[model samples]
Target: MSPRNKNTMLVKLRNDSQWSSWTWQQKLRLHGKHGLTRFFPNIRRKVNEQYIKYIKSYKIEITPYLLSLIDYDSQGNPQKNDPIWKQVSHIDLLSNVKSADYNGVNLNWEMPEEIHYSILHHKYPDRAIIRLTDNCLGYCSYCYLAQRTLDKKRKTLSSSFQIKWNGTLEYLRKNRQIRDILLSGGDPLLFSNRRLDQLFKDIKDIESISTIRINTRALTFNPFRFDPELIRIFKKYGLTALEVHFAHPKEITQEVDDALSLMDDIGYRPIILWRSPLLKGINDSCGILEELLVKLYERRIVPYYLFHYAPYSPARSNLSTSVKKGVRLLSELRRKIPGIAFPRYTLFHSSGKHDIPLVQEGTNEFKYEILANKQYIVKFKNWKDNWVIYPDLQDN
Candidate 1:
């Protein structure tokens, strides 16, 4: 390990040999995190075999940096209620829960209106996304894509996304309507720098494509990946911005700040923006989120979108906060924090993005009004003509 940077309390850089020796998978293994083995010996000894079998059903991976943040006693007993642990570690409550696909974004493959290619999803004419890989440095327990990855019958990574590069590019060139291309997957940053360099170089030249964004969680897992060479490539290619996923304030450490600072020096204004699902018990409180959002703005990272947790399955249903609760929380934050510091609390539906109703002026009591089977034309206070229908109010 190298000495820590004086200004920020993170390691300046790892030695060359130290960096080369450990692959990403090797780091996971060394941290005792690939499977149930990361649990304390006492817990593992007492846990039932059925519980162990349940955890094995889904995928789980934790990075070295993240593992260090988990709280444990001197005797190596992992804490049961730690927020970081809740995000990745499996709980007994999910054992009997049936698996489900909540978002149905994958069903886009069946719709031919905008999906010109099998792997690409173009919900709108002007925007599209390319999935680069099915691998990520850290795996969140509530990940939407986990449904596909856990299914043995389906292939998560297909040749269409990887091998048919020329054909995909040709489709983009022919349409001339796509102005934005977002590279995402398990995490695009997990792709090799050389591979990313080639992809950026190819996309930057397309006249129709004006903005490119890389969605990643690497800053939380492996900040060192943002080395000087990678920074240089992003600058050369005129990379628009990066959307990073961070669920809790504890995840924002000095190391993460140092990584953002690297992008700051390269003339990347508002370089990084954050997007996170509001998970119950983890980051649902106004105090936790208020502090996290303020810290983000101070670091030059904009609070982009705070998503309402999707009701994916019976197992994950507890994570979804009710619309009434979400609105009340956002209303509280709006009252205390500056408007610029607040993020749009939204629900993602097949139709479009609908802002969760913030306040009902006349009523002194704050509560959700259930409008039955009605189509709502949700309007934006700031932007005229920008609106989406409320898909359903029954759930509220």
Candidate 2:
């Protein structure tokens, strides 16, 4: 839907009491004159039961603010280019997914391993990821979190807050070492403002968590989700900062700019996670990656990381962008742009903090480091301890 159409549609829906009361599923039917039928072009030939069911039930919602930025008429599915598509469509890619370790990321869920109660396993006691929401606004064809995040119906979000979600809160309270809560789930923004506001307040009460960074694509997937009211709620409850996951420059639309302006007005600071799944056909070029970083800097959003695509489900051919391509792009981007604008081109390697930087080793091998490994495997071991080699350090 075009931005104008989306806005017009939203206004129409809002005015209609019946529309406002409907579940997201119902809204899709109203979105276009046709409801379930709208998804037929994409799903008709496919045979994935979970996805077929999802598309059957899932609503197609693009807010006016976000839709306005899209070129709906020219493109076959303008929404596909929109970040909203990034969130919703990737689950289909799950059927074609593969493992991340052979390509670069050492994948594992702390689940049965159980160092802690998370899908995440961290090295330090001072920081850890706390997943509050179990829903994603869109399912990426190349989602790393597929094993944990999918299956929408069973995911817990109690209409009543104090009653059902209290157990999650109690779990966090017991783990005092977690100073930073890197909010992950499907996407934290998938939750309603009321649910999130209460959740943040409860976390703030814990006192151990100082910095709250949300690993989300809301800026891309649902930019409209971040409003003045949401920003106000975040600020009031001391939600420190936001991390917006914007992949390529194409993903950062004018609507995102407008939303950022709203956030700017409310004094909400954000760091842009300029990471890509590096999908083969999607965005594998050094130039595209560099342009994305440049645009991010132009918007004053910090370029954080260019992630190596996690090969999880469907297949590597469908999802994994070559490790060689990732490393080359990192080198070229670093040479072309300044350090800040250039994201730390890295890959998430496991339940551990290993973000392997795509770098050239002497024998034509590429290597990076595991941030914190169970055992010490130094990818970049500096010999600063050599006393005679650096004699100046003796007196200093």
Candidate 3:
């Protein structure tokens, strides 16, 4: 059946009185519209029962807005350029390999023993995270939060603190060192404007918190979400910066341009920064990377960190490229692109963000050593320590 038919059948079956008041996400769940099954039924059928099994392992969601951006004609057809296809699509990798936590990032590991809140993860001394919601407008295949949020047994903060931010605010108020609090989660933009305004207002009152970074991918998922009202709220709170993820150039659409234009026109105190994983098939090439960087620069958005793809999730193993290749790409970009356009390439570890050596090695042979202090030691075979080149370290 077509997606429209499936959705129609789903809507017709709902008998709950609160259905009308449900948010976009609630409606999606009521209709089983969380994964590839919601669209391209033929492809889902082609993969057979394995598709069902794969989503059962992970909560793979593609919002209707993001779903509309996918180039169905070119999807899975290598002859065409379908960067969006590679990003959200499920492949043989998910079915063949069992799910494994590759990055080792867990809520428990970062959370302090004293804090009872699930929304806060105080990993570093000066920075902390306020996981607003465990929900997102769309789900990326390579999301770092996949293992934590997707697990049914795990309770997420997506809905818990919607009405109040007292717990997190109190914690921030007491700990003045936390200058920044990243509003992250499935995507904090998914929350209603009223809820968001309240959340930011509470934080804005805290004198110690100078920076409020809004982490979201809604620019690609649903650019219109940044309406005038939302922009007004953001301005009211003195939003410090916006950290947006754009894995491939294809994800940058006319709508994204307009959304960015809106932000520009609004004259925000918030500086926009671009960040994305260095995915193998999606954007490993220098040509694609340069184009993406140029586009972001055109929008006055600064290129930030390009994180090395974490291979922990079996679903995105195919997307992970070698650190050597990542280094070469970064080095080449530095040579060709302007210094301002270059994003620092780095690896994220449990300890903190570590610089990925920009060393140009002859072969792929490399060894990694995890020191007792949680620092990493990576050495290229047949190369002396003098050959290693390190990028300027930055805390994430």
Candidate 4:
């Protein structure tokens, strides 16, 4: 691993996550609810089957609060931890390896000077993605980048964001054809308000970088970072737009709600991104997803992408859902739910936005399907008008 891949202590903590507020003793007492032990058997064992595997996978410390959410009861089954189970307990997804199709979603020639180091991935020329930084406030057990981050050699590689920051900025500055820049990866807000300001400042200065978007979860796990001063800085950077990543309804709390409201007050209204892989006993049910979407609407958050877990990292073997099946779940949920709360269904593929998915289609453009059944067909009533062309593309 080059020096560029190294991650900071905070970022490293993310890959090897831990709930700083709690103690290990407390965690053991509440590792599971009801009789979760019998089902997974050995979870509580000093060196249980799952724990040993998780350690090998390089998964960070699991907080007791999160552990308490798991189900151990005879009747609880895997569904008990549906919302968060797949994030960590993904032994099944890794077993089924599905190849990725990198077609229409190609980020194009903006493909960059370096393949492995380039954070930018622009599939639809209409919009471009800027993998601005490679760091996070906290890491998830099911993170696709787990292997990429855990390899000591890749540690500096993970921190490549800081290393390439200048070159990437230069590339964006020269590309006038690009209109939108999605600030992604390692959660942008994990940085200090001042650091975020400098980033947005550079971005806003660019003539082509019109809309600024970011994907983050600091508001959920570390709302303190969403301070008024930080929001104040964001409010000052009019070019930046905020996007929140929420895996399930359980992730939304009053604190998060207040933080979003604060963002609105400070000038950046956020779009909510709900993503998680479909684990067997976890959140595969149409009813559960529908309910979660409804909750999102209640809070005035626009539900963006509801994703089917893809095969990546240690959890991939245990957590992935079938392309056909994922599509089906989305179709069923859409039919049973209202449009206001329904989110756009999509999946991550090498091609970028392979809507529909490996099974069917998100559209002639794309669709986010869970099962082959195509249960949720996400369509915007006036989808065409929701966004305006970048002017240059109108004639293309």
Q: Which candidate comes out best when scored by TM-score?
A: 1
| Candidate 1 lDDT tens digits, 229-312 | 788888888788889888898888877876777777875543677998887788888999999899888887889899875444
lDDT, candidate 4, 360-380, per-residue tens: 443433333233443332332
Task: Give residue 102's lDDT in candidate 3 (0 to 100).
Answer: 31
lDDT of each candidate versus the true structure:
0.63, 0.53, 0.65, 0.52
* Best-matching candidate per lDDT: 3
Residue 224 in model 4: shift from native, Å? Answer: 3.1
After TM-score superposition, what is the CA distance of residue 232 in candidate 3 from its true location, in Å?
0.5
All candidates: TM-score: 0.79, 0.70, 0.78, 0.67
Error of 1 at 110 (Å): 9.4
Candidate 4: lDDT of 349? 40
RMSD of 2: 9.2
TM-score between candidate 4 and the true structure:
0.67
lDDT of 3 by residue, 289-369 (tens): 999999888878899989986535534446666576778788888887778888988765444555666765434444444
| Prediction 1 global C-alpha lDDT | 0.63
Models ranked on lDDT: 3, 1, 2, 4
lDDT by residue for model 2 (105-207), tens: 2333333453344334344567766565556654455556544554333335434435434654565677787788777776777767887787778778887
**Candidate 2 residue spans exceeding 4 A from truth:** 1-26, 29-36, 39-110, 114-123, 151-168, 270-273, 362-396
